[model samples]
Target: MPSSIFINQLYRPPSSSSPETLPSPNTGVRAFHQSLPGYKPSPLVSVPAIAARQGIRWCLVKDETERLGLPAFKILGASWATYRALGERLGLRENGDVVSLQRLAEAAKAEGVVLFAATDGNHGRAVARMAGYLGVGARIYVPSLLDEEAISKIRGEGAEVVVYDGDYDQTVLATKVAAENHAEGKGVLISDTALTVDDETANWIVEGYQTMFDEMEEQVLEITGTRTITHVVTPVGVGSLTQAVVTHFQRTPRSPKPMVIAVEPKSAACLKASLEAGEMTSVKTEYTICTGMCCGTLSAIGWPMLKSGISAAVAVEDSDVDTATKNLQSCGINAGPCGAASLAALESLSSGEELALGPQSVVVLLCTEGRRGYEMRSNSQPEP
Candidate 1:
């Protein structure tokens, strides 16, 4: 069969300015998260073997496997967005006195507002975890097609789980309708991807992800003694995390903005299709092993940032993900299909002259998740 991979360059403006030059909500989001209990920066690890194989001087992986006691990095965004939205509902200012999750929970309970969201796996679990921490109720909508392992994990967080019979995009719509018809007026929809709906909370979700970049920036400088990040390869699911990475590097003062390449499952390469069409577009998607990146639509809140900041987009096949995951394991890193997809992109780019990675290039791959009952096997040889 022909390779199911696709690549496209985005149209960037001539005089584009970084969002960091302006005041951002991420500053407050970062501070809020830092104050939480058990909050610590995730590790930025250097994989010498992978670097050597790719012919790059440095290959750093920001391991988010253990973030906020979750197997994925979704909590960073879920926690911040939940806190900010809850604070707003309680009439708290942006810079209001720092409050505990318990206090926030009490206020939420009194107001009878329950946190709500639709997630593939990690994001819902993250939201449910936050709801448990804050002592509030959460109603999570998940696709019926989700693996039992992930569904069980979300339920373990004390959230009322509703599995809709459809795909992720359909589940998102169902969750939105449930929130709209919530008679108690307590459901707060915190979706990661936005369609034709109110996207304020979606924007907060994107803002919340900025904490990852903040931590990565500090960690990179601490480890390398130089803030030189030449390239960033991350999985694109509705473009939220990708937007966060792009905006952070673009906006941060005096920081070298790394070229961002987004990786997606070929079956669900919505962002790649969007870029090629020069507009927000959706694609007909089939199930892929990379469940977290199986989004068929782009987030309205994230599209603009990605359009302006991303250097390129690449879509790969399941075999590529399997190879990438096994290779990462050989390097002593545990990554799920979605997390390891970035390395697969790197492998593709390194093989040809597309990316031109060299000895001086320092690349960062965002390993967005840890293995969660997913089998990791090396079924194919690495591409040259």
Candidate 2:
């Protein structure tokens, strides 16, 4: 499929009296993250080369390559949601101490409580890692098309990896059913995506991503001595992370709220399709190198926010992602195909005036993952 970009006609700023609002800089979530081992803010880097090539003042990347010892930002959402979902059952308190967490792990193990989740890659590994921290077990479900390296990483975290013979959305349903049917050991679903907007666990997962933006805002201020971010480019899998971007930039009282551009694989551009249809729509996704963004459907909870808040949606072909990966790697930023999709989207949008990016514009690309191995679906060689 050819690459395309859609300007959201429904895009509008948040009204001062709007009831739909997500809180900014959630301190409690940040504090919880700070208490975890290997906790530190991911770097917000300015790539001058990219900015010059793209004709922007600065092209900043919020590098999530090494967040909490994981290769992606999925850990931020998975860990936070797991804590909120199973905290009481495992006797965990806010900012729970390491010793108390260890003791509660033993209690949780005796009680047979387990964490259940489905992912293309990063989220499942994160859930398994969280399960290890709490001395419980985890069962991670993945689509049959996922790469072996991703599956191996999840299994290495001591979780049982189940292969579902379907796409990502179907795998999520299978995982939900398995979690619901595991009558012996208590299973708690810690999914980040949902079929309905009211899924509490999914909402909590969205809340868990607050720390990333909080850190980005502080870092941007420290580096630029200003808070005038004109654009935030984010990759959309199920739209949960895009929802977080809109919540952080739109809800702020800051004037001229940053325009959010959501990027997705051309074959799996579900959010872009939904935005053009003026209603939530699902598409049949084809194979793409950006496996992480290969979701076929949009999260219901994120539709309203994304449709109204996102300035534009860009869907890029695998070749575009390959070029982006090479560009980022040349700069010593080990961004995978999915993570580099934001750069590709920016390139697509910059070709026209839809974005209105200027010399003073400081664009932040949310690079959600580091480089990983994957088979090339196109005729071109796989990203190195």
Candidate 3:
């Protein structure tokens, strides 16, 4: 494999001042989600062989392949954000009061409200799924590079899919503009990324992702007899999921904070570049095989938390991702490109001196998605 990993240590311990803190995820988010039908925790899987090979004590993959019937973990955030946004609009404030999809649909219809967003694939599909559940209209914008299978999936959920002849950032801008131009009370932009840190919907999106970490806390203890997560490796597109991981570990009262490693495609290393420049930055990117992670800009809503929370950020090539995906397959874990990027980062760090991996370290990789119709491998067979 060609060496294509660039690592940057963004945070160091014994800092002069404390990092900015966000509101902790309350029990209400968990209760609301658990109340929904078919709400089960995704598996926290251990790959002993891979851990042994990497000279680590344990390697856990948070298998989010089938979260809430969605192919990717994006649904966790999208659904939560959608519920909160719609709930506020409908004047439903009490946490104990269950807001059913029927109630949401009736309110949305009466108020002429529609959910809108721009996505590379998974997030848009998730928002569409939520809209479908609520029997509301959904308008999703996608870049020209999105695969046909993903587009079909979004449309299959009864969402109006609009393909933009621009890159992901441009598509996001267009969606934002459209939402602003929509008739009064007709459109609600439920974007995971925004230009402002105080974007309520975007903040809610990050909070929505807290459910995954809550599950991980319980499952990690049950499986490992300890709640300490030494290291976390996850892909960074807009950094929403990564921010959630950082917040969860930082806010947990007794648990030791994990070293967060953010992975991105070499073609779109926005977060890495931003950290290097010491400011929010944007990059021009081409089509990368890791399509889901092809983001050029860091999310304004997520950057502050990621900047202060992540230990390091890495940019890996597409070939590295392919190797990682296959390696994960050998361990019986199916991961899409973006999902496998976490494993690729782990492999890179294992051979380097930047992040230590020893018998005491417990590493958790986020397998954010599974292979849908867009299969990157020829056969689904595992290597011996």
Best by TM-score: 2
Q: Specify the poorest-scoring 10-residue window by lDDT in model 1.
A: 375-384
Candidate 2 Cα deviation (angstroms), residue 153: 0.6
Model 2 is weakest, by summed lDDT over 10 consecutive residues, at: 375-384
Candidate 3 per-residue lDDT, tens place, 1-384, comes to 323444445574313224344475677777767766578999999999988988888899999878888878898889888998888878865565537767777888788888999999999999999898887889999999888888999999999999999999999999999978888857889999877877888888888888888899899999899887788998899888887887777667654567788899887888888887778899987666677788998789778777767778888867788888888888888788888889888887754456666878899999998865433422233311
lDDT of 3: 0.82
lDDT of 1 by residue, 1-384 (tens): 434444445535223674545336446777878877788988899999999988998999999878888989999888888887787778765355546667778888888887789988999999999888878888999887678898999999999999898888898999988987886677888788878446777777878888888888888888889988888999998888987777666666654457788899887899888887788898876767787887889898778777767777888878888888888888888888888999999888854455557888889999999976654323243311
C-alpha TM-score for every candidate: 0.91, 0.93, 0.92
Q: Each model's C-alpha lDDT? A: 0.81, 0.86, 0.82
Error of 1 at 355 (Å): 2.8
- Selected candidate, larger TM-score, 1 vs 3: 3
As for TM-score, the candidate ahead, 1 or 2, is 2
Where does model 3 exceed 4 Å of error?
1-10, 14-20, 95-98, 351-353, 373-384
What order do you get sorting by lDDT, best first?
A: 2, 3, 1
